[model samples]
Target: MEFIARATAVVGGAVALVRRIGAPGHQAMGPSPQIPEAKAQGIMTLKMPVARGWKEGHVPTCAPGLAVNAFATGLDHPRWIEVLPNGDVLVAESKEQAGPPRTLMDHAAQATMRRAKAIGDSANRVTLLRDANGDGVAEVQEVFVQDQNQPFGMALIGDRFYLGNTDGIVVFDYTPGATSLTGAGRKLVSFKPHGHWTRSLIASPDGTKVYAGVGSLSNIGDMGMEAEEGRAAIWELDVASEKARIFASGLRNAVGMAWEPATGTLWTVVNERDGLGDETPPDYLTSVRDGGFYGWPYSYWGGTVDDRVKQDPALVARAITPDYALGGHTASLGLCWMPAGTLPGFGEGMVIGQHGSWNRSKLSGYKLIFVPFANGAPAGPPRDILTGFLSPDEKLAYGRPVGVVVGADGRSLLMADDVGDVIWRVTGA
Candidate 1:
């Protein structure tokens, strides 16, 4: 592992190419999007920012009139977070599991994963943190659940708590204030495992059903479309019947999902295909429709055909265009809606966490941003809320922000920094 990590670093530095298009934000966030032409590369880009641990007294920078503090630290690769009704936060401390490599590309991907500190044994546990006194810090912490597969997303519906594991959805009986769960809950639905393994789960507004986002097994169906069976789409499951069906298709990898409060519509942030330079087929945030196809391997950004994949004119014609573009290769993963008046200057907007780019020469999206909305649609440009994750040279990353949510109190924001192993709380100054 050490040899592969060192080799990837040395080779990546020598072969990586920088972005020709200056900044990614200019092409992002408008109604009529301007997607740049694709620049196809002969070799896969190997630009990964090295992860650096934060200094003891350091934290992320905040926007003016806002303050940032560490809510909890010393976690094991915390990737996603969920807030309980009782002011407790549950964090899924997980790492990706290794699979056998079938080709040279797979070996190269594994080496890159090691260099990025992305591959290892899964911690397979969830930790609970409580901020009893209303301060931004967690006063008490405990292991809420344990001994599971790579868990990513979570949701609580009445007395039942749903956990989205890489291979299936598990459910458990819940008591509000309890610290731990006793047994491995029943499997509600089993999913087919593939390359993209993080299952993002959410419940319906009325709590009658659960929705799980299953990403594609390979980029552009490189592993064959048959392997993508039951993958790369959002699966809607009935809580009572344990029945599941595809609600939407061709999403590629819809990592973050939330229900738009005003219109009661579902929205998601998807990570698009790579190896198409740094600017084409921008990652997007869009309203998800039932039985809708957003175009994955066949097309991108709504009907822009990717020549790499086998052409399917009929499928491309049916692709629904996304509501907003988030920039190419931003890896935009986390999504949450803040109610009106939650924070001053930012009124009723969506907070998205860009996990940063590994395929681009220059990094993008290692920070948290806000997109203001009016009447259930984006109304203005995105604002940077938390930054300083990347160094000025863009070669080192201190942290990568992932799951973000509006705090239970409704006045603060909570973000899970996966690479930093810390959860940060932000409040108005």
Candidate 2:
């Protein structure tokens, strides 16, 4: 029975690919995206690319007037990045935990990840890179912390260091300019582990609190809504007492977050649920408000009900429409604030590292982008900051950009390329 179901899904996917019938990618972008009705296939549209590492002396193509280089190379699946006050770069090297393939769709998903070089035993460590002389490339590289459970985000407030492991947030005592963490550290707060297990962390500008993004347990509550009790929401933690609460609810997968400077508003890039059609509901970038709800399983894009789930009209009525759409399945992760003069011609904006798509017929994202901001709102269309991560044929991928941050020098941009196993630095030409 499982084999028959799998075979049927494969044939259906092939036929859909041949027809090439889907919404145009550009039509589902920016502030006002053209969202169509739901077109849920029995199985997902899988277009996984084979991972091919960068060739010697070759790198992702930067936008004109910008140059890029491998700041540090040969790391093990680097996924997220953080910079310390002393100009030291910390990278979290990790991978998702593999579970048993229970359903035909799960089997197909596993195969897709295997081909994409995304499934493996995690490195489970955080590494430090330093460019001592202010050159673009790092002269010192060393493992800063190890034996972690898929660590993704790192923050340092005063002398206390916070690490966002998959199951919980761990706090460590640290000394400035130290090379590595020798202490075992204790868990500050616990979170349910496994499903959508990237716990991304950011500290308040005042260094008094921390925010963490936790994703849903399944697509649209397939695992039962009760199982998703504390998932799919951003959490706020008080540094002194370690008390935590949900900051915002109904974000399916809010991986990357940043604070808007002008308004001090918290903003995030959320990856919406899959299995819907190519453009049923676009992934979005939005300002996260306290006690607010953005639709997930019950609805999306402001009360557009997903009929697949049990209807809840009351929750749907309160669903907040996102500020801007980033196109469907773009997997817009790794967000950071970019000040006006940080990268030459670019104005104040947000830098987004899109990890690209696996659940769409045609690929989306696969590059770094910048959304210009004016008066604390998105002012213009997204601009490509780096391109060519995917080959022209779109079958081979050189890299997937994750966790982006302004370099310690405040002029260059640093991005983590997990598939390529390198950290790329971008600066004015």
Candidate 3:
């Protein structure tokens, strides 16, 4: 492990000198903008911001007319957030299970994970936070669910609660205001795990079906395409039948998903392929189509072919372009829509939690951003909603924002800060 880590460090340093250049951050965003040509690198770029964490009485910076505070603190690594019907928030305190490296790339990936503070024992639990009396803090906390395998996404339908474990979907009977789950959950379906284990879950508008976003087994099919079956795609499952099928394909890593309020269309924020320089193949947000392919392995950003993979002209031709580009190597993950008139200045649009970059020379996307929407599509450039996750020097990150969701009252935003192990609440000042 030591030898592999040292070798990767040496190779990464060499790769950084030849990093690809492209459009500036702002020019790469919005409905229509420039997408620079991709420049593939032989070795993956390895630039991770060190985790410094926040000091006492400190929190992330909020945009004008807003205030930020810690809602819950001193918890395990909280990655995803789910707001229940009764205004209680459920936080998935999770981390990837550490295992032996299988290859040189695996060693490099593990080193990156350590630098990003992503390597740790899975918490395998969800904690409930109640901010009663509208105090902007979680005064009451309880263990809502426990003993799971790296739980990420969560959804509730009628009396059924669903959790997207790294390897499968589990179902439990839910009751309003319940403090903890005692009954053993039944497995709804199993998934092929190993690579990109975060399975983000969302329910259909009508509550009859559920969607699970399973990421690819390797970057650009490095492990052969056969290992990628049912991966890098969204699986649609019928609640009654326990049947599942791929809803959409070629999404490298759809970590966060939401329903656009205006058109009732499903949308997702995808983490695009890395190692293709700092500015190629921008991570994106788009409205997910029922049977659409968004380009992966064979190509990216619609028909822009990645020369590294074997050519598939037919697949590339059918690939659907994303709605908006977040930025290259931003590692954009969390997605949620705020209703119109919910917050001043920030009207109807989607809020994304950019977990930040580990492979970019200059850091990008450690903050939470709001992308304005008009008629159910991205209308303007994304605006910063929360900032200062990184230090002024940019060498260290105090925290990395992950899952985000509008408060149950619709007047504020709640974000999960995994590096700091806190849930931050952003509200109108």
Candidate 4:
């Protein structure tokens, strides 16, 4: 139970490039093989693996690196997680679930359904956990904010915790040694609920600005969802003044985000538009330019336009291509930059936790992948770092990985498995 088996296989045959474990001076480059799930099984029954310390790749097997294990089990529908300066983990347990799959072909109509779902009170919650004794495993878990319509994204600033709720944004202050919200949360800002429901949060390195990811109300203009109406955007808010503006636009659904160390670039793992048949428009990872506009509704990848929306000329011309596309419907989320290429070796790596897709006939993405880079961009193709959370037969998924963060121990990583309702500690290889 303490051993980690890292089986990294390519998803396609060898291309022009194989990703390198890179360094600070990378210029970027890429290639691959297709691997089936059976080749990467971490034991058969995947009922949320029983953790016996850090049973990750590398290390001397799964030994206890830290004793304080952060528990997120009671988090109802947690979609994101964060670690504060004091080491407390904030869990954003979103109560919203799409009211069944809407017709992807419908642009405006489906957006309505998404908005309605965000307003549902069933899945909204915010909680905190603490392992005060440096034991690594959490002994205290408590609700910091509750009874909100549906909460998704969160960021901690000084003494306050900012939340991205269904209809708007709010905040609660924190006190060391405490784990729950004490006083009433102060409303910070608001935006009308659109058809889509995604409120992811990230803060600037200096905490001067706060970032929020609000997904488009519709996919690529279906049902007439205009881009200006809050579809696919990264919003920037002034923390000191509380002013807001559209930081970047047309990101489809930027699910997870982090700041890169090499160049301090803002990186995002985005869930691109769906329904282009399987493998049409790849999900992508890219650096967010201050006012950059990513492609949506009208165009994708580079210059590929969706014929489905050709009639709308205005929307078509404004779209911008993505950095590099991920294969269709991967639902990419929860991203972090890894300093090591493999265990004990300081190679360049980007780690992303795919939340898995239900739309594709052949299910995909229920685990983690390593995107090795050469200089500063994706060096080669992606490889599976942590798989087996999804059944090969595509019938069931034991867990849906949401957020990933470098742990208290600099050697390993921590993952939030939302479906299984637990946070897993994974050491390097």
Local distance difference test values of all predictions, in order:
0.86, 0.89, 0.86, 0.61
- Each candidate structure's TM-score, on Cα atoms with residue i matched to residue i, is 0.96, 0.96, 0.95, 0.76
| Residue 70 displacement in candidate 1 (angstroms) | 0.4
In candidate 2, how many Å is residue 145 off? 0.5
Clashes (N, CA, C under 3 Å) per candidate: 0, 0, 0, 40
Off by over 4 Å in 1: 18-29
- Residue 99 of model 2: what lDDT? 88
Which candidate, 1 or 2, has the higher lDDT? 2
TM-score of candidate 3 on Cα atoms, chains taken together: 0.95
What would the per-residue lDDT of candidate 4 be over residues 1-429, giving only the tens digit for each residue?
Answer: 011111100111111012111211221112221111111111111111211222233111122222223343555556777777777777777745445444332322233223222213455677777867855567778877788757777887888778888677788887765767688888877755654566778888898988888787766666566444765788888999998898888787887887777787888888866544434556788888888777675666644666666445554566565555555557788888888633343356688888766443344577677677666677767766566665555544556677887765566567777655677666532
For model 1, give the RMSD to the true fold.
Answer: 1.7
In angstroms, the error of model 2 at 347 is 0.3
Q: Cα deviation of 169 in candidate 2 (Å)?
A: 0.4
In candidate 2, which residue pairs clash? Answer: none
